[model samples]
Target: MKKRLSLALLPVLMPLLHACTTVGPDYHVPAHAAVHAPQANGPLLGTKHPAVSLAPVPDAWWRLYDDPKLDKLVRESLTANTDLRVAAANLRRAIAMYHEVEADNLPQASVSAATARTQISGESFLMKEKIPVFSIGDVGFSVSYLVDFFGKLERADEAALASAEASQAALDMARVGVVAETVRAYVQGCAATHEYEVAERQLALQERGVDIARKMVAAGRGQPVDALRAQAQAETLRASLPHFKAEQEKAAYRLAVMLGKPPAALPAAEAECHEEPRLRQAIPVGDGAALLKRRPDVRQAERELASATAKIGVATADLYPSVSIGASAGLTGLLSDLGTGQTAHWALGPMLTWNLPTNGVRPRIHRMEAGADAALANFDGVVHKALQETQSALSAYTKELERNLALRAARDNASEAARQNRLLYQAGRAPYLSSLDADRTLAGSDAAVAASDSEVAIDQINLFLALGGGWQNSPDVTK
Candidate 1:
């Protein structure tokens, strides 16, 4: 019995100690590029963006929007989005798969039953034999387990665990994206509202100009063509008012949908959207190493990679002999009715299955290796993409800041010029046309400044997405 025990278990136990030696390189996450990583680049005293401002994004970062309406929308979207439901289902599936893999490493027992009724016709074969009716039923439970003389099952379970983690991260990533898009749509809605107001202001000024030109033409001081030109300008400005208002309304509806509501169903604004999204003026992006850790895509990529690495072990295990043992008991009847205890059978011995004689195992090893390679490349791709996202976000935010400064300067100059022109008109030194031109230019500058403010806000939100925004507080959909 001792010898038998040793024979059955020795092969499995030895290989387990060296489970790490399957074939190709064992997986470990590769290092990040040294360009921005201070760990790789060595410490710098007083770096570009201070660590304090570079805090990891907090969960529920949307509260920074300072708009209760936005908070409600994000919460509503999270609960109602169909895509989130799908992600939840996928997570459950991964959990089930993990359970299945874990089960393989434990003892498996199965109970089965079979009943047979047979009738035979024979003439010359058995003339002396009595044509007796017979019936049989068999039932038994068999248990078997192949101890992990190898880490095959363990590795498979590890891979499955990683897969589950990856699924979770993917879900989180989706949540982040959905929330960002909803915020983006809200910002757009708010910008549209501001644009409509600007159009209204312009239209009012154009109407005043038309009245001026009409009076001048009636007094015979201006030609009929001047009245026509002023009327055309007023009509043109009026046309834009309708268009801008329509656009703003559509933006509001889109925001409602993103909040998971019928556009019309959402509460109407007694007041227009007043969202002020506060973000760090100077964006402080962390180094690549830390950045990689924050990215969900990076986490998901690593999980897939671990799974591919484990498949090699699974395929390699198939190359060796698979052994089994079994025992069973049953009953059969002839003259009398015999049910459960009428018959019995049992056996216990090494049942060896050797498939190494075939060349199938080598091909599978190659396939898994190729898969592992692909996964590594994929992981590498995500890393670079995340780096680029962070860099691009910060770079864009910087440009938007500069643009805002330029816009402000232009606005200041335009306001001063319009004031001087109005003074000159009052003093009878400037023609009415000069005053009208100055007013028009000043209005244009004011509108431009409004648009630039919205742009800066929009770009800052984008920076939030790229930097990985977190939820500040869960949105209260009930509100």
Candidate 2:
């Protein structure tokens, strides 16, 4: 009986033996992976300075400032920011979906039991008038396995895994955004504070000009119009104080939100940061090749393309036949004969299913192909956009550096001229009008220098953002 049973199972196992053939084209990496490669020489169009450095950007690029306060704020934002939390949840969901798809490769089994009572009428037979009642009971176990003759299940798993990776890349991108914005808000607040200080200094200088103008009038060496003109200038400078304070408050509020706190929760030290932090050295900007590798948006696009390629295989596999094997064994009998072996039964077989061409197979294949093409196009677009943004940021940063240098020189010249005018007026050589004009010129130059200083810091942060830093703090998110 054992030998007969083994022979009977041979046909059921035959389909599984030949199930290794995969039907569709396998995915391959594209030949031109990046749209634009870093040129041998720098592509920066501004001043001919060495293009920063060819070194790879550090993960925590902001730490180059050496500000412990900035480092602490960035760390806090990573842990508490609501947007980053949402991205983490999305990554977990994608990983779960991949596991769900993987479970299809295993065999399925189930058990069943039932009991019923029925009545049969004897009147259905000739010359009979009575009815009889009987009880039936049965229990069984069954198993089923799908033979993956065309690799449909494997391709599905491949697609799911790629999607999970794409989700991880998206989380990295969110980290980059939050870190850059937090730094930007902090820098702006400091810049505003510096501007306000510059304004106050200018007001004191104008008040001294007013005093000189009055002294000239009392000594009968000048007209009253000169003193009135000096008074008007001092009033004008005073009017601008409220505008500068509002700018500083706006930046403070934005920084508070970036740290995931109420506007009133800003730290006292940060609110009083009246001096701007300056970078001591040139920024490090790696080549375009490194940029393509480090940017999260580019990675996400490439993974999406891989997922779409795998889905084509899954859809095309449907054009072929599916094979399955199933087996069942059980016992059934009247209550009186429950212990008898004569009630035993078993069966095993293989099943084949196929769709005729009249069914809509061709249209489904077309749909999958179209989706794959769209994904490929999207990947190319992302690469181009990344290169464009990087180049634009480099040019802008370099130009801002050049402009700041020029402003510094002008400020030095204006300060010297103001000193000379004050000395000459005290010696009775220059008129009070000449000293007042020199002081006004010096005040304007000071404000311009402060504004330019702030812009340099802002442009530097923008360049780092284009290079994609800040994801280093949460290294596991990329994995």
Candidate 3:
């Protein structure tokens, strides 16, 4: 009897062994093929600037700055920044969601227990007379699995996995932003401090000039107007010191917030940085192809496009019938006879479900199709924007470098000229006014150089940001 029963079930179980075909269009990375080729008309690589290179970027690009404090701050922020924490949480949520979708591919099993009291009517088939209340107890175990005849589950899993990947890319993007912003704030703080020191020196020199002008006037050798002019110049230079001081304080507060602390809190070393950060080495930014591959936003958009494509397959599979295999084993007897052999019962069979075309089905497919179209467009737009930002950053960085170099030379000449004019005036070979004018020019040149130096560092940071450098250590997502 067992052999015959097993033979009878063979036909019903045969289809379960066959692989189901995946339905609908398979996903391809939209527009990625075009990005692989180097365009001759692409933005010019900065060969003219000695601080620029075509070498591949380092994994820890910030280390190239050679600032240990900066490196430490970046590491700390990576671990504690609120934005990164949020992004990481989102990624975890996506991973959990993916697992939830994947669980649908496995068999579902459940167990249940119940107790009920009921009375049958006198007119019921089991009751020839008035019936009293009766109590019944039951327990059962059931297992069911939806067979993927058209790959609906597979497509759903694919979409879910893609979403997880996109979330990971978003997390990486957040890291890049935080690192860049932290570096910018640190640099700004240092530059502002340096500017303040320079302003103080200029103010002292102007005050000395004012004292000299008053002495000359008291000795009947200089005009009162000259002394007034000297005092006014000293006050003008004094006015700028407060602005730099404010900027310095603001930078410190920004750094504190970026490190995930209160705005008023800051590390002592970071707060006391009074010298501008400088990079002595060239930046190794690889070609445009590598840039396109490295940017997280581009990766995220590509993943989204893939997800939208997978969803179309999921929707398409709904057009076909669904099949499920189910089985149950249970006991049915009087409460006192639950353990007896006579209480055993079992069942197994295939179940089919089909929903005929409804008015809403085609519209739902259309909505999915529209979503896919939007994703494709968005991916294309992201690729183009990434390239644009990279080119723009490169242009700004190179031009700022050139300007910084020019300002350095100009400052040196201005300093020497001021010193010579002062000596010549004291020796009676040049006028006092000439000396004052030279000193004023020197102060302006010094301020310009300081500002340019800060700008160059910021532009360097921007270039790296545009290249998406901070996420190199991130784990690769499984597509």
- Taking all chains together, each candidate's TM-score versus the true structure is 0.84, 0.85, 0.90
On lDDT, the candidate that comes out on top is 3
Q: Model 3: per-residue lDDT, tens digit, 322-342? A: 888788999876676776888
lDDT of 2: 0.81
Put down candidate 1 lDDT per residue, 333-440, tens digits, no spaces. Answer: 442455535555444544455686366788888899899889888887776677677667766666776777898898789878877875775465776567667767
Off by over 4 Å in 2: 1-19, 33-51, 110-141, 218-222, 328-347, 424-433, 473-479
Among all windows of 10 consecutive residues in model 1, the one with the lowest summed lDDT is 43-52
**lDDT agreement with native, every candidate:** 0.67, 0.81, 0.83
lDDT per residue (tens digit) for residues 118-168 in model 2? 676686675376666888778788988887888999899989998999998
Separate clash counts for every candidate: 8, 0, 0
How much does candidate 3 score in TM-score? 0.90
Candidate 3: minimum summed lDDT over ten consecutive residues — where? 35-44
Give candidates' CA RMSD values in order: 4.6, 4.3, 3.6
Q: What is the lDDT for 18 in model 1?
A: 58
Clashes (candidate 2): 0
**Candidate that beats the other on lDDT, 1 or 2, i.e. the better one:** 2
